[model samples]
Target: MSIKVFLKRVLIITMIILIIISALYIFQDKQRFTKKTGTINFSTKTEEKNILVNKNGEWENFFVKGVNLGASKPGYFPNEYGVTKEDYLRWFNLIAEMNANTIRVYTILKPEFYEALYEFNKDRENPLYIIHGMWVNDNSIEETMNAYDDRIIKNMKRDITSLIDVVHGNAYIPQNSTHASGKYKYDISQYVLGFILGIEWEGYFVYGTDLFNEEITSYDGEYLKLEEGTPFEAFLAQVGDYAVEYESEKYEEQRIIAFANWPPTDPLIQPYEPEDYNDIAQIDVDKIKGTEKFETGMFASYHIYPNYPNFLNMEPEYTEFIDDEGKNNSYRAYLKKINNHHEIPVIVTEFGVPSSRGIAHFDSTRGFDQGNLSENEQAEIIPELYEDIVKENMAGAIVFSWQDEWFKTSWNTNDLIDTERTAYWLDEQTNEQFYGLLSFDTGEEHVKSYPDGNFSEWENSKAIINDDEAKLYMDSDESYIYFKLNIKDLDLENDSVYIPIDVTPNSGAYKSSLFGLEFDRGVDFIIEIKGKENSRVYIHDYYDYLRYRAKSLPSIQKFTEERTKDMDNFNYIYQYLMENVDIYIKETKQKLIKDEQIFESGKLIYGNGNPNSDEYNSLADFFIVGDEIEIRIPWQLLNFYDPSKQKVAGDYCVEGLNPKPIRISKIYSGINVKRGEELVYSSNLQSYSWKEWNTPSYHERLKPAYYSVQKMFEDE
Candidate 1:
């Protein structure tokens, strides 16, 4: 055959193969979307033999693995912008892959959530179930624990009614709802497994309130009062009663209901127990008049943390039990005591630890603050906690969070007034921001990054250069920007690392430095370090600008050959340093106190510097572990605004100053090697350029559980 004819035949054959492959791919995609689980009626809630049955006809035993899904992230609000369909799709599928069947929301979410969930479950045999929460106005009752407060009660009732309406596929339009208007609507009640009534109540506020003795008649012809339980429990009962009427009236289906509680409302123990009550158990859930009277039952839910409320400090009777780790397992002891008191199924609604560096408080036996767990430690603790929950016969356990939330704060972080701590950056010391299965950007890259001179924790971080001889990696969380340098056979005596920073972004000004010889006037700060012994971090303006490269200065042209060499000549470099060192070098007044314990344990510890100290700890800390050196610089010391608080450019950002308290809006940084005053090697010589990109500054060691998350999206 002719050449053209042969080519045409080959093309035809390729087309035929492509058609077949396309058909196979389509078939696979359809199969992946098809559900494989059994389907049952879940339109109405039912109970048989004291076990709670879901609307789908599946019975929930003590095996509930779930996560708390919040709408707000560190700098983003899900309710205000509305959770994107893509996010819901990714999150729901991931949860399912983790072997979790349910998710609990703290409050009513935007319409997108409902729509995405409905679409996700469309034509599926087994769909992800939701435990919806009705958020109460905590501010109203915070000051006065009186559940009978007319405004709070009325608003709560209204919110409950509105939430029910939205779930029941009614036209319930919230005033500030985002992305709510749409042609598609769904009655998500079938997928809703239950409702969490309110957040963890401050039981102390209930002390003198009418919640204890004010007698009130329920709509169901049941009498209730504070005498039924503690003031807080009485409040929960009254609100729960209203929920029953609101939900039952709207939909014929019934669902599990529980009031959110923390250690404050715990029956096991309380750190601040009053004279009248030894524990939170005095506020009983079963004491409510309508609790057992109704067909659908109510259970108790507590946000339990192992390290909180000094569980080990409980009376010897409570702290007697010990776990395999040999630590006082008062956590289990507490759970057992509460389960024995309430006949109905009780659930640990929130339980998990945070992967943060800081410790709010450290118990002698327990170690650090409550929930301060490392990533690996947090992952390991989950299954163990689940086992305990199952052993105690609790209905289920939902991890406190699916991802870190930067917007949340801890008791200690609340008092910080620095601009960097203004909600933009992750506070590693604040354990609350690090408790998610998936890490999210807090003003910094991650919450807390340790510069313990080890680079193993930095594998997931973005590297500036990763050549065989040396590697430069950078990462940040909300509070600090960190850099790590790993070099082979590093010189400790004469060699040093130099960083030139352009604090202002892209202004196109250039300044020349004897050390940097850089081509930019925009360089605002320079940090020079030698081994782990001495370092200087100062504003670029600390140098007398007018005196730079002055003709009057004695010319040291003889040392030109020594400066161009790569290896450090300590003696020759020291000679040039003595001759040309006229610049006013303002060394940081901050001290570098070596911390061996923090480095060895791979933990972050924010040091206690004098509050009135004029010198900011810009290069806060550093350590040398092996051939690597890790450095941490606080954002505030560098004068960078907390990105979390920035809505647009020029909003609460740093404006560069002449000398101290240098304000930096943006910066470009680089490293250099030097021998005394001689520039042995400079990265600026290779490339004097700084570029900015859109990504969080902090770096987290843990990545999202991708396999598990992806598996959840599958039809099976």
Candidate 2:
């Protein structure tokens, strides 16, 4: 054999060895990339009293620190679902940054939401989980007076199917007026932690459904069964079974399941509570148990706000219960009771206080009222609520909302405003609209004015009444109508200022008989600044909201009449008072009285209204500095049904006490000086108008509560 031929063979062997080594390295590199970017097969299940998640091939307890994400912007309704993909992406980043491990959505959102979620979690080491929901049509249940009605049942079934399909990335729902609809191509079922079905059941609806269907007592399905339950509970069991069966058969996957419940419909018996509150209806989640086929388990989900239903405050056991801080915490007591009663893992899906200026409910013991709390106060109370839930051995807690929704209306103020146009402007006086950690503030770039007694923001504003006595400069944003009054020789201690504002073309009174004052134009509201403690807003008798409410109640129809025969009379806009009278419950055959009280609605507070001030009070209506007085009034306080369209309240007496949509192009205003019911001086009526805005200008800002919550969640 030749030496050259042997060398050639060795060279060929060396080249073959190099090729195999390079190919092996390339295969390993590809595997690494796929592990980083490929879809994760995340699995979650409920243990006896906790949620266990399969993380890095090991099952561990997953305490869900989550936030509820609503599909609404500053100028859109929830039904509209105007949230975009960019919005979802940005918000998801913020939520992850806040150390939130999960997000709970009320219903199926547009396809953009799923796409964003999939893209966001694809490459992250610790992906955020989701708890999707299926919304029920409450209008159908109320109108048909039967939960088993064909329309309601069919809609629920269809929604359940659609939710499953959307999460699996194979649904193409057509566009509809009510709910979101689009083609979903992103398979995000892996990250879905669970499914929360239905909404907060109305007590009457539950009772009526059971009464109407007396024979339908139990539900037996392939995955879930109810041995003995009410008609409503049977309905829930059937739905839960259908969801599990569909997911298992179609995709071979199973996750946790929960039905939305609250205090009014809870099964617990509270003898101290009113029969209507506790005994009228019951939704026992325990009755709906899962079968062996259902691999994942169920949990009890509730929307428990600290200050609601009056039972939380009135119950002796709850109010007297002490906490770790040695404080009487009715909220924690109620939570412990719920946790002890539930056999499954418990999750408070919705629980948080609103940082709003106006309040609808009050909590005497815990100070966690529905509203009337500052941002800092909200920041402090939320962490405490979470602590209570954790100490009670609960599974999880999700904050009520992620961002403020402008279209929300409260029970107390809903009758006075235009419900349709609520999203066009911000109403600080509405408690329900200000419940989020993210706030959408006014102005295209920055705030127009901050009623912090600073006059620099008003430099570019025009004066409506520039005269020798005073120069009144007016400005406005989506939240408030600002006024800067520069009066010569103004005296806050002795002199009183009366500002009468005409917001509508019709109604109002030419004279205020209460203050012994007359106006050049018919005015609907009057701003009387007597002193720091006595400042208040007075409304015309013909346009008062209490009269409208009185007309609706048959027992109090006589109160609807005008208090004074003279049309030119005005009265203080007192808050609508509620009193619990003795009512005999036919079922229990016992008479009971609930709690009630009155509040001064129109009273104005004097302090710094700027967000930058340490003493900032969101309820501050006016602040005085030297001879210049800066006043910022909420549009709703002036009886503006919809200020975006320049709409205000009309004469209820003539408009038949119903909502009369009245629009005005301009508002007339004037100022005058008085001393002890005597008019010292007056100015001519000045007209101010602004252009109607279809799309409101706003910027997103994270509230201080977000940081506090972030810290607490990170620590967890």
Candidate 3:
């Protein structure tokens, strides 16, 4: 062969090689880590002390089995219904009566609430730790909140100071907070317990901001439309002073629990990358577990949500790399991911299907009902999620909120307050039963509950045994999921279950005619599970077809290629990574008040930055409400499974060779900011001006042919 021909051949081969290796890294889901999945065990110092977190087995023992009274169906104490001492005690006593061991208080105003709660439960024999207030909203702080914020800081100091001052005896206070005030990270540095925030919340950023990358989506890139620059980036600038506090102090076992969003709608998140902690915190990368472990009362937060593929308006291929089910899975990978990250007991911080009301409808055809999963659906889906949380040796789960507006007010509400709010309120009100652990009426008292002993412990909750020979499925019909107890005569009364199913309701406005579980369209489920302790064929799920499906897809490759032969010829792996991983999603936040992008129907669109009114009819870059993005990127390029030599305990070892997950943002992406970016670009792009931009002609409007992206732009 000619020399020139040979050179060309080699170049072509190299590119092909690079593509394949990338593909393999992205497409395949395998781990090279020698580390075993470790779980954090808990126990309190003593159950007698009013203080529960002594960092001994006292936390582990008592918390091993308990229910978050406010989990499934939380009590709504509107601002109108003030938090009186009587109200606080009634809430506590109510939870105590349910036989539940734990009580998680949602976003609270001040430490006084905790003080009152502590005082109210002081006499009770059973002790509970206040999982502190939730979601410190930074978007719009109300007067009540402003007052509460001041109180929180003062009360927190007071609460701790009080503990130090006059407690019956000296004891360590278990302090923790699940705060999402990104900008207030510095503000919270004053508190003892470090904060817990899944980085994805702010437009699903995996890491804070890249000072170097100037792209619209990278770091403080122009694409950001929220509060201008990132709070983390701004916060990091000050980390220099805290360097002594942050650096010298090792990453210890903290009460901070973080979880990743599953089947994340944004395609740019992966499990192996620490930055990809869209929903869950990247504890593995963060080195949260220290050699010096917690003695007790430790808990890791886990976010649980069933697969909802339809919500993602993209091709399955778009998400092929990140998760198999294409953003619609509740799978073993998630279980395996966190298991390797922590030694503390896992607690599901948030787990609930969307109700039909206020939930943003994605697919127009699919209504709000998915958000409004029926009680039967709720019973079928949530309990299994809860069971799985417990089976992983988790402490417990805290459902989204005690109470929230499934459907809430809007600007248009002023047109017809009674009709709209009433309808919206009624719709959401009906869904309370779905997560209803028990009936709680302002006027009536709850009858049967799980306060102390009414409910069984984690051991008692185990309905399925995890072993070598266990393979089961959970199936469901419209309303009911029946697990036929594959293993017959297996006792479930004291058994905990790991049911892997999700439930969603159709969107619409409809009341059950009354508040309760007995209503039409309310999901009803039963496990027809089968198993045998003798011969030992176990039915993991009780229902026959009413069960959960695998949310993530298993990696598939007909044949494996050798990469060691030549590092340059790694195209197979690279392509695989690009196809599978979500590292490609670069988050761009356009401040609603800052930038703008829009094009009327007749306007054209283009990236060349020359927008005009003559030709373009429609606009591309506007953030309306409920906007989501589907991204694609190379996984290996971001670095995964690096086996650099290292010394661990004085032994030279090959480390960094494990599943390096990718990222997705946990926070909500903006619409107004997005709209602004679009308008800004639209007002300038040539498509809108010259009428010949990438030139979005009628042909480009077609679905698959729309763009390089396999996307169907449908506003839900």
Candidate 4:
């Protein structure tokens, strides 16, 4: 009952109350910083009114701003680049920051991915969502006609079921040769918005295959047969139904499911005739017998590109319309038909142009194959495509890739094998490898050197000696990549000339293939020129000229009288190779060279005229002042996207030529042409190299294009 004891008790009680209050404040602070998830849901109003809705119960008009992630640096596989936990964290954060809410994958990746997803979404509010995919191996097809082989179908069904199990954390995945085995580490089904089943099926092979006898005789009383109805379409329905049912059975949730299709199945061109209609995969979603299974959520999906299959040139069977540029633009017209045929929402899974110097296919009216586009060019056109997607009132669109894949082979460059090229090198000639918005970081910027066909401009630039008695000097500036060549007693008339440049350094030979004195492995662009009137300009290529001429040339053999073809045959091959194959060898050339009149004059007849002008220019001009030829090529021609990053000056390096700079010792005997009975001879063929110490990486020139792509999607 002392006064001192009573005061001490009151002080102790006050201290306890303060501590509780502090703890509550700390908890509230943590809650404030934590993220909230706006999960997607689907609602079925009517057969035609099904839509994607947000968790808040609002009609979700979420246009999918998504990117397809591929390990594009060291390899195309997920675990190829030695991806660590930190890398996944950084990449996911970067993707989210790029204003993309969705990241898509082609197959079930290693367990590290699932774990990364868990770490990323643990407590975050606006967590990244996944549009998971089920991969079907097409390599196992015994015959092209056996598109719906029972074994393959069974395997696909298993893949889908297993993938669903992985998503819901219900399966223990054993490490296979392709995927690292581990237990499903996290339950990511809550964030699983959709599933894409299968890939672009080449329906041409299975045009009239009757692999499935248990076919639907009719759907809604319409007569249907295996031949009348595409087998691929039937396969898609089967896969889609299985995916939806599996997801629903396991998670008890409605998830969007779409079948992956491309131009071949959809008939890149309009099926004007009944014959045309019989072969292609019928994409009309309503007509499918299993539409009921997809009643939960169905979206029309296709991989469309402007150039491939030359859809623009095909005359619309029913009708067509003009576009903004005003050239009977049937691209949107084709898309409109696809949209009209499908009652459900449409989503373009893959649609993009590659930044490459080699060209595989070319179109006069529409454009080039692989949509041959530069990184900067891709930035400009991609927005227009997205705007079109929105204008078409579609659900969403995902860019084909996130980064450049060095292991990828294109239709044009796949034939040639290069031993020196490393797996990390970005082959500018191959369009398939350059589709990604991001690229591998290739070190520091090189010194600025300009080419005006004048040696004085290259005084401060580095020079390298060559085995062929040629003095080679190289330099680059913001607007152009310059080269000066001084060869004693040079034959500008008969000898075949080649300058193969390696833009990506360390990616030295992996496959042993020679390409016109340049290492086929690491070489980005190869310039082949002869003394012909319009042939004085550098012929851009991804591989050497031999690869270009392989299609036209005779088989390689020793000098034998019996094997040697007549001069007429050789003449024809020579002319064709020089005019068509050499200049337009790689798939990337679609971005630089045009199909028509590409060799017109110093003023690039078909494309952008002047290098100095802001207009697009692909051709490089040269002034052959006697033995010294000074050539000036625009930076854009070399696939350098941004001009503002160029410098005015750079210090000179006196390093001797690097070893084996050229793929071939010389341009195949250095005798490209023989006309008028004047047999020209190439006495000396040379290969030279200079120090790559200060060379700017392809990643640097292409950064603007990559960043702009991210910014664009973000702004949208």
Candidate 5:
């Protein structure tokens, strides 16, 4: 063997060895164990399924999906049982990242709480929404009597701004005689969460069904078990008893109505309570109009808390009542009646169950169903029960929600953020935090409990949580990004206008420029903009178009009892979109482009999404598209306007997490010229990032001028 031959062979062998080693390393770290809950492969041809008002004033629905935040998160922040603005902002960011819309925010006035909120979050350029009505009883009169001189309630009325606010209430009879006069006032939510808010939300509700007033006749012919006579006579007496009892119970509710200003300018809701109907038993029919002004936009609002006993107690026979039809059937039939008679939009604003680990308001003793029923079962049951109502075509519904861990109760005794004992803590009372589509505590994926029971979780595809550690990858086919996380710790010194972060179609090309996996502060976690596109936190921004994203105002004909109830997917998206529209629109520009390269290249679909698209980009964008739009424009444009007051107001949202006001437009409104993407600018809300992002000399040396384009545009 010659020396030359041997050397050549040795070099070749070494090269092969190096190649094999490289392949092995890449395979090991490149998500070799990628496992998704598969994916929903179904597809629909129609781009939209919207609800419109038909000629007859009926809701015309072709079967489109949407969402509504139950609108009853307690309004206390930096206190017990709540999240801070940053956390709430994160949640809203997550909602948007998840691709959802709509938010059922309360329109009640709470001036005391507002002062702190206004100082921290309010601004002329930024905006806030003032919902006129309460989603439930305004501290039920009972709770009010026990709490104070009713000064708080009156002061709370200041939360309203004679705009498009709708009241939400869940009293036994949907009446508030004291505040609203002798008529029924459906504006206030239960003063203290009752069986509905306190416990699992009423699950079996259908639009227009008389949820509480179902007239039942038992086949067993067993009725009173009270007076003498046959079962028939006894049943009749029982019916009268129920009718009379219900009449009186409802009267108290009417008192609130009598006391509260109703029908906008009209003095009261039931101004003309018939002279004869006034004397009907327990109901107070004689009281004339109370406050003649509805400073809030609330006209007629009623709420029903569905689940377990609230229903059973009203009609004890319901305990064992089963029609030839199943639970969904018998239950919805009665619900339809309620909606039809009320002739107003009613939200199933509160509903939920509890796990043994926690106690939801519904059943204080509800055991460890977390022990008994599998998480899968609980998850499955939720969507079905709620979706059924959405199918009924009622106005909207919000799930009774509390933070994931401290939701039901607090577990720890010390810190506000770390506790199961806090109101946000999960307990049987809140069914241990299964209330949200995504579990905040476990961060595990669970399927919505109904028809599309096979639904899967939307992944931030680039982030792979392998074992205890997470490996993230980012990709963009278009431009470079100069991402800057506004953390105080990191040594970040790039104050250039030109984005420096490189963006490629491949996810591994770029690296993280700031913060670690777990962050402990709000100021430390903000993702600053300037690059073509950068790393995105899974935030659930739900303030933006939550109130007026009426993408599909189904015709009255389309709204049947079977057309609207507890719709999980839609509600999630709606709230998510509402919160983040401001963020999204902040960067979206009015300067239209020939091709929105990234979004289009990603092959994102913005209309009614088809589960089956041969080759495409964003699953998130495709799934939550506006029904009418095949490829969507940002919701700010679709729901409101390009960047008008109405548009910003429509997108403006504020969660109790911050308790501070939310300013949608002034903070974030601009078009990303280079990549044709949008950037949200929020330098004024509650931070000093404006100086950092803008590099204004006076920012550190002098006070920032009240309002300047430089100050405004610098945040982005």
Candidate 6:
């Protein structure tokens, strides 16, 4: 062969080798990219006593570090599901940013939620896991008084099937008024940690079901069965079996399963508990045995709050128990009991304190009351609660909520306000509405006015009382009706300020003998400011809610007088309380009489309401500056039943105690100043009217609690 021909052949061979090496390099790079950005196929299962997640081809013990995501915003109910895709995306980012690995949602939400979750996790290295829930029809259970009622069972089964399909992302649910409906194309089953089966069962419903269906003691199913269990337990077993069977058979997938329960309906007997909170019916999850086909296994779920049922306070074991920190921690003691009782992994689905002004329940030992806690205090207590859960050797702890819900109502204040209009406004006084780490303030960007002694926000506001002595500016948002009074010569020590507000036309007083002043319009509520520490709100006797409640109860008729149409003197608003008292007549006859007591509930606190301030207090009612005073009053405190529709309270006597809704376009308010005994200055009645809004304006803000929780989760 010639030298040139041999050289050409060598060059060709070298070019072929280079092309092959480059092709191999390109293929390996493509594989690496796909592995980096591909869907993470994770599997979660319960081991002997812990929840283990197999991600990245290795199983590791997983602590949830989760938050409960509710489906309501500021202006909608949970059933309405007013959250949008953008909202879900933003919130998911926030949750992830907060270092929360999981989010547990109760009930199937709109398709946007799944879509957002899928899109968010598409390219993420570590994605947020989900614990999807299926809510039971509470109304049906109450109406039928049986958990195994035909209608209830059928509906529950249908919901189970629907939720299974939703997680697998192959279901098309039709439009419905109550539940979320749409084409669910996002297959997020891989990221789902587990399923929580039902809502917190009412004690009475469980009792009734067990009592009536005593014959139906055990349920046998393909995947799960109940032996020597109550009728309600059988129903739960059936539900769990159906969930396991459908998910396994239809999609060839199995994950962790749990039934939702709470402290009130726990199987344990609290002898010192109230009759209502006592174990009305036992739902023993231990009786429900899983078959070999149920590979993932089952766990126990509960919604436990620290302060409730009164048993935690009264029970000797919990009260005297000491925690790892060597403190008498009742919460940790209760959690230890629960953990010791359950053989399977236990998860506290709901646990957290609320940053609310009005307190519903008290915890004397730990001070983790239901409400009346500042944001910082709430933040501090959440991590402490989580620590207790972790120290108890439980599966995980999911906080009660991620954001504050406006539609929630508490037992103490629900009757005083209209339930229909709860979504339209923010009620800081309602404990249920303030249980979230995120808050929705009453403005598009920030609060309209912060009672932080800063008068800059009041510059654009119109002055209602522009007199020689004082100028009063009034403004309102979804949260509060704000008032700024600039007195020419202000004295927090000597002079007393009285502001009489007329919210309703039916019942009020023109003359308040208590304040020694009269108003042009019938004043239903009065604000008396003696000093920074001695300021409070008072209601006219005819319009007092506590008085109305007392008068409405037939047994307490002797303690309360008949409601008259006549305008009465203003009095401090009181909280009605009833207690059993022993009475003896002439030392011969003994009787147990239910006596009523009064507690002052209208006392106001003064602090900086500004969110930016280091001394910010969410419960701050008023602030006094050098020569100015800023006051914020919740709409419910003034007996405005539905401020969204401008509806106030009507005459309760004529309306049979349940006050009729009275609509008013404007509120008439007047201010007066008193020095010693003589009235120094008085202003004419000023009418403040605003356009009614069915949709409220609000902005999402992460409370300080979010960072506190984030730090705890990150450390873990």
lDDT of 4 by residue, 1-716 (tens): 79999999999999999999999986874453233333323442123523454655655556677888864344233444355667677778877877787888888876677789888987877678888876666565535345456657777887887888788666677655333457774778777778887776665444544444336323221111123344555655666666666655445555777777766666333433222322354444444543443445566677766655433443453125666666554456656667776777777777766765445544444453353455556666676667666566666778777776656765434433231232434444455766777655333443233223334646665455333455566544322444567666666665544554433232222111222132333333434445534442222222123422344444444324432222111210111111222232122333222332122111211232222335433222444545565555543333322222221111011111112232221111111222223423222222332232122343323333456657777777
Over the stretch 204-284, how does candidate 2's per-residue lDDT look in tens digits? 888888999989999999989999888989989998999998777666678999999999889887665654744578888
Give candidate 4's whole-model lDDT: 0.51
Model 5 per-residue lDDT tens digits across residues 445-541: 3211111112222233322112221121121100011111121221212321111111111111111123211111211112222222332211112
Off by over 4 Å in 5: 1-85, 97-100, 106-153, 159-305, 313-330, 354-373, 402-434, 442-716
TM-score of each: 0.62, 0.89, 0.36, 0.64, 0.30, 0.89
lDDT (Cα, tens digit) per residue for candidate 1, span 1-716: 99999999999999999999999986875453243443222332324213355444555542456789888554454445435778888888777767677788887777778888988887777677888887766567765566667766777777777666667666456463322333225778777777787776664555545345555422232322234445456566677777775555445445667777776656544432222222334455666554343556667777877665533343454467776667666677777877887776677889766766544433233443344444545555655566667678787778778877766665543433232333345555456777787775333433345554335778776667656556667765555667777766667776776666555442222444345445333554555666554564554322212112233333334324444231122110110000111121123322222211111112123322111233312123676665677777654334343433321122111222122232333345666666666765555311222233333353323233323333332322
lDDT per residue for candidate 6 within 1-716, as digits (tens), equals 99999999999999999999999987874453234322222288888879999878999999888999999998898888899999999999999999999999998899999999999998998899999999877778779988888878888899899998898877789986437999887889888999999889988988998888989988888889887789999999999999888877666678999999988888787765644534566677978988877778889999988887667866778888887678888898899888898999999999999998777777757899888888889999999999999889889999989999999998767877789889998876688999999999888987878889788888777798897898888888887888889877888889999888888878777787677887788888888888978888887766666665653333323224433545653343433322112222212343222333223457788999888998988788899988799999888778778788888877765665577788999998888999888898998779999889998999988899999999999998
What value of lDDT does candidate 2 attain over all alpha carbons?
Answer: 0.82
Q: Per-residue error at 175 for model 4, in Å?
A: 3.1
| Runs of candidate 1 exceeding 4 Å displacement | 1-51, 54-62, 78-82, 143-145, 176-184, 211-227, 268-282, 289-293, 311-314, 324-327, 362-372, 417-423, 441-479, 484-716
Model 5: per-residue Cα lDDT at residue 181: 13
Highest TM-score among the candidates is held by which one? 6
Count backbone overlaps in model 5. 178
Q: Point out where model 3 deviates above 4 Å.
A: 1-81, 110-112, 140-200, 204-268, 271-285, 288-299, 307-333, 341-345, 354-369, 403-425, 429-716
- Against the true structure, candidate 1 has what lDDT? 0.54
Q: Which candidate do you rate higher for TM-score, 3 or 4? A: 4
Model 3, residue 247: C-alpha shift (Å): 19
Model 5 lDDT vs. the true structure?
A: 0.24
Q: Write the per-residue lDDT of candidate 3 for residues 1-716, one digit (tens) a residue.
A: 99999999999999999999988864552221122335432223222211234332333343422233332112222322233445556656644543444555443333334445556655656554444323433332232222124433344333333222211121223333422111110111112221222222332332323222223221221111122233332222222112212212222122332222233412223432212334321122122222233222224454545433322222233223243323332333354445545444555556554332212212222122233232233434544444455545554555543333322332211111222222111222123322333322211232111111112212233222222222122221111111211222223332222211111121111111111111122111111111112111111121111011111223322222352222222111100000012222223321212111111111111111001222211111111011111111111111111101100011001111121222221101110011211211101000000111111111001111111111111100
Native RMSD of candidate 3 (Å):
32.1
Candidate ordering by TM-score (highest first): 6, 2, 4, 1, 3, 5
Relative to the true structure, candidate 5 reaches a TM of 0.30
